[model samples]
Target: MKAKLGPAKGKVSDLAQQHGDKIQHGLDRAAKAVDEKTKGKYSDRIQSGTGKAKDAMERLAHQEGTGPGPGAGPDAGGGTPNGPRPPVS
Candidate 1:
């Protein structure tokens, strides 16, 4: 049982790492698109928010081994009982 579980756990870890990278890449691309569409007018704010979102996502990926649990920072608003709410006003 232990021998069989080792490979399965390794595969799951690899998949999670790949998925996390893909998600972060997608977020970067989306941020770039938004900046381009706005002609760089709101570039600073967009980049800031994008950074935060990426961080949150990475944190979530890291927390996967801990079972289902809250995955957001304290300032991430506790209003939503499901998951992290949007970091916007």
Candidate 2:
């Protein structure tokens, strides 16, 4: 069970690194669309969920790295070692 998950987690982590920006962008866009459609009724909840999802993605991508990438630290919400965090579409 655990052994099977190890490789799967690794692959997912790799994909996260390869597509982190795109993934984040998609999440942000989806959240924004939902919020707009709901006229802010669920804005807080949407933002909270978005943050968690982005955090998870970052954690997965940076699992083997030294620190939290973007969305963290003094320089969070700016750029990461990989590159500038892409603008939310």
lDDT of 1 by residue, 1-89 (tens): 87777566556645656697787677888888888889889987997888677666655545444233477666553221344533321
Reference-based lDDT, residue 34, model 1 = 87
Model 1 alpha-carbon drift over 4 Å, by segment: 1-16, 67-89
CA-only RMSD, every prediction? 9.7, 7.4
Give the TM-score comparing model 2 with the true structure, all chains together: 0.71
Q: Against the true structure, candidate 2 has what lDDT?
A: 0.74
Candidate 2, residues 27-46, lDDT tens digits: the string is 99999899889988988788
Worst 10 residues of 1 by lDDT: 77-86
- Residue 48, candidate 1: Cα error in Å is 0.4
- Where does candidate 1 clash, by residue pair? none
TM-score of each: 0.54, 0.71
lDDT, candidates in the order shown: 0.63, 0.74
